[model samples]
Target: MPNTGTPPLPDTPDNWPVPPPPRQEPDQPEPRPGPNPGPETPDDGVPDVDGPADLPPNPPRVA
Candidate 1:
């Protein structure tokens, strides 16, 4: 029991390093287009966004 010989693999170049260039979805910061983007209408104009009686009757038991 003595012939240990099986360790040498680093030639990876067929399609290995090419798969890491497709993850470019991280440049997202261009979202500010509209008459209201978000949160801005509480002068009785009503935009509190709750409706359904404000939805808080009973939703706390998270044990």
Candidate 2:
């Protein structure tokens, strides 16, 4: 059997083909206002795992 060798890489990264651009989104409609209760409600005093005390002042809001 004859010897086989690996293919050589391009001289520079620029020689690589660029990836396709990200998908575009259509214009979105204005957001509607959410519900609002008439009067101020009292808190139930339940502990929040990721609330003010638990998280840093400028905590990241990730999904």
Candidate 3:
């Protein structure tokens, strides 16, 4: 059998190309802190979040 040589490697620094410098984004006005809004409530002033009564238990997974 004839001898086969390995292919040449790409030109890279430590097998990785040099990354570009981080980009600079334009500055925007700083946000003014205030009272954070709470989650929405129903007209009856009660949260409509799900509870154990919301859904049936999941079926067992098949092997």
Among these predictions, the greatest lDDT belongs to 3
Q: What is the lDDT of residue 28 in candidate 3?
A: 83
Q: Tell me each candidate's TM-score.
A: 0.18, 0.28, 0.23
lDDT of 3 by residue, 23-60 (tens): 77659866887655456544553434542233445899
Candidate 2 lDDT, 1-63, residue by residue in tens: 554686667689887889999988769976887665444334445434333233334667899
Query: Per-residue CA lDDT of candidate 1, range 1-63, in tens?
Result: 565796656787863455555556657786875554365434464335443223335777899
Candidate 2's error at 25, in angstroms?
A: 1.8
lDDT of each: 0.53, 0.58, 0.59
Write down the worst ten-residue block by lDDT for model 2. Answer: 47-56
Candidate 1, after superposition: displacement of residue 53 in Å?
A: 32
**Inter-residue clash pairs, candidate 3:** none
Worst 10 residues of 1 by lDDT: 47-56
On the 0 to 100 scale, the lDDT of residue 58 in model 3 is 81
Model 2 lDDT on a 0 to 1 scale: 0.58
Q: Which stretches of candidate 2 lie over 4 Å from their true place?
A: 1-6, 30-35, 38-63
Candidate no. 2 TM-score:
0.28
